[model samples]
Target chain A: MAITSDLRNVPLIGQAIQRLCSLAALSDIESHQIALCVVEAVNNAIVHAYDREAQHEVQVIFAQYSDRLIVQICDAGHAMDPKHLAPQTASPLDFDPCCLERIPERGLGLAIIRTTMDEVAYTTSHGKNILTLTRFLKSCQPGSARPEE
Target chain B: MQLDQRKAGDALIVTPLEDRLDARVATDFKERMIELIASGNTIIVLDLSKVEFIDSSGLGAIVSSLKRMGGRGELVVCGLRETTMTLFKLTRMDRVFQVFDSEQQAVSALSGNKG
Candidate 1:
């Protein structure tokens, strides 16, 4: 699924990912969580990689196997700094929840992805960047999930 | 980005009409809350009963609203879906704001605090 670097289209992409996750026999919570990870990755591509420029392209490719799901978000905008690829440990989640001022308002996207997805990898070459997320399916069976075309 | 609002004494109960309150409408949600607060609707009961999905951006917007309120007002959450609640717990935000099961309970808590 390809969408312009726009926030308005994120929910639609999330819904589609949720449906696909369900088809792979994931539970409702798992479906929602995985969908969220994909959404976060896509948001990174749009907001960071493309600098929120709607004219740029962000491509999301979903591949499901017997035991796992892999999603690759590709962008042609500015390559993300390698340090930002991995989620930060010092995030709003690490702070005392009661201390409102201690909690940061933003930068929760990548942290949520790291918390939810089993594996996260990013690669860039020749002005293109790709973020790959993989989640192993606990209840996956042969033929349950369709292979990528 | 429709919000169903009703006044329960000094508290305002705001329910998001949409099922998904992700990045798409998070900013708008925050701005609406700010608008209400600036207009003297201080004690807010954010009813999340209709929100089936919420992302990090949505969570950030909720936090921003709380920050906007500062110490002058209250921002309590109610009707968190199981999925959204899980996200709250993951971020430990469940401890920051008081959470209730329903709008009535939230309103009751606010009323009790005011008294």
Candidate 2:
């Protein structure tokens, strides 16, 4: 499914994720997680990928393998640096309850995507930034990565 | 992003009419919530029974709504599905807001009518 870079069309991603995950025999919970991750990717693409005036399009492709379901979100807006996706490490000594009070409500999109999807990979080629998220059908383990077949 | 609001024992019960609250309407949701706060109803109970899915933007909007309340009143959330609850827990927003199981419980807790 392809959608313009608008948040109003985000529901299509959920519908696609649900339909594809259902066909893959995923449980309701698993389906929901996949849908959430896809929604996050689409939202990121719509908000950050395109210029403020350009009407770029975002592409979502659903592929189901024997053991996993792969959803790829491709956008031509802006390429994302892989370094920003790396997990941040901070010292525990810097932690303060007051800091918790100041935690911004946003920026959890990437964390949610990483926590829900089994394997997440990003690549840019031919002026398109592709984010591939894979959810294993059989594994409930966190941070589990299966070699893509 | 329509919200159904009603008065219940000094607390305002606000329910979103949409099934999913995501980036599409997070800004509108925040605006309505702030409007509610401006109307002098500080104790608000958000009934999310109809909200099946909430993304980070939606969650952020709700957080900002809470912050808008500014310690004057309470913003209690109830009727969270397991998946939505997981999002709250994952983001640790569950600790920031007071969450209840049912709208009645939340209204009662905020209204000082625990019975």
Off by over 4 Å in 2: A52-54, A89-100, A139-149, B113-115
Candidate 1: tens digits of C-alpha lDDT, residues B1-115: 8999999898999999999887878889989988988898789999999998888889999999998888688999999989999888877788888999999999998899889
Q: Model 1 compared with the native: what TM-score? A: 0.92
TM-score of chain A of 1: 0.89
Which one is best on lDDT?
A: 1
Using Cα atoms, each model's DockQ against the true complex is 0.70, 0.54
Which digits, one per residue and each the tens of the lDDT, describe model 2 over residues A1-149?
Answer: 88888787889878778767866678777788789889999999988887532467889988776667788999997887786566563322222323444756767787788778888899999999999998776844334333221
State the DockQ, from 0 to 1, for candidate 2: 0.54
Model 1, range A1-149, lDDT digits (tens) per residue? Answer: 88888988887788888898888889998888888898888887787887788978888888898889988888998877767544554554688766668776788888888778889888898888888899998876786555442
- Which regions of candidate 1 deviate over 4 angstroms? A87-89, A143-149
> Which consecutive 10 residues in model 2 chain A have the weakest lDDT in total?
A89-98
Tens digit of per-residue lDDT, candidate 2, span B42-98: 888999889999999999899889888886778889999998887887777777778
Task: Output the worst ten-in-a-row residue range by lDDT, candidate 2 chain B.
Answer: B106-115
